[model samples]
Target: MEFDMVAAALRQDAADVATYARVLTVTLADVLPPGSVTVEYERSLGDRLKGREGHPSRIVVRLGERTLSLTGGHRPVAEVHHEVRGVVLSRDQVSLDVWVQALARELVAQAEADARAAEALRRLVTGA
Candidate 1:
């Protein structure tokens, strides 16, 4: 998707307009190494807020934190270890820069790692 569209999504008001799931379901599956890095689950810190009562239990779209979960994908790489990877979205406390940066960084890193792993796996299989 275009960056403008993403920025627009961030501008939305989860408390009033965006859905509980919509805010948290902005997915970029292929951003990481081919199935190398995965979203295991998401945890919400929005509970500490007040007006968010009207929102769903998850009213944010924070990647790697709320909207996405990390599973055992990048681990197999054994060459690169990335922990901070996801967008950060909330009802009123949203950080588009942080989220975008995190996602981009992870996406690039994972893409690179996946490329490297592909060669590594190929070598292993071919015994070359």
Candidate 2:
């Protein structure tokens, strides 16, 4: 993920919106599975502007039966929500925490996989 890309996407000016959208599209392409990421932006509502005063943006990622959503504006609390239906799961906060932990574990697993692949390639080149 590029800091410039994220920074650009978080910019405030109208002229910057296209640049930001391009950056966001590229960034999402890098992290998201094929055909799984959706990005959208909308003008600030009057009520929202009374307190926040900026455009609202959203990024949604769908992975089979699970969906992860992230929404943000010029506000402090950027909302994040996740839902996993079609599975036997508890409808409680504990389940939500468990899902969060599972996602973290999956990220760690991917990192480990990348490390192992890199080591193997290094060993092959060095004949180690």
Candidate 3:
């Protein structure tokens, strides 16, 4: 019964995260140029949520070829789980307004790096 109760709570959390993800996506959409970025939300479902198994619900932020996945599930404690490419960071909170600002900065940095690399390649190719 206790497990069931906790699972139910977690499921609710996942749904809440989904709602937050949608709104966050909208805000991100406004900041990122069309087609430059994408946000995805995943929901938890079915009968069981074993440990951290089911609360995988989260939002994915993709900027060009780089990606960041953020989640707030059990153990997140209003804080969030954040993953940048291969790096996983725990005890983070997506609830903070700073999260979005950080994301924007990182995305912009990635775009700038890509642009610089492309320009360098072009110059090399043209022998300029």
The numbered model that scores best in lDDT is 3
Please tell me which predicted candidate would have the highest TM-score against the true structure: 2
In model 1, the runs with Cα more than 4 Å from the true position are: 1-27, 33-94, 116-128
| Span of 10 residues, lowest total lDDT, candidate 1 | 70-79
lDDT of 1 by residue, 1-128 (tens): 23333434433422222231333243333332343332222334664354333322322223233332212222211112223554333322224344433434434344455665334323322435
Scored by CA lDDT, what does every candidate get?
A: 0.33, 0.40, 0.43
Clash count, candidate 2: 0
| lDDT at position 77, candidate 2 | 19
Across residues 1-128, which tens digit of lDDT does each residue of candidate 2 receive? 22232223233212233333343355323333467656666656874667753443665545544454444444321223444564523322233233334333332333345655334323322435
lDDT of 1: 0.33
Q: In candidate 3, which residue ranges exceed 4 Å CA deviation?
A: 1-16, 33-56, 77-101, 107-128
Pick the winner on lDDT between candidates 1 and 3: 3
**Collision count for each candidate, in order:** 10, 0, 1
**Native-to-model Cα distance after best TM-score fit, residue 87 in candidate 1, in Å:** 20
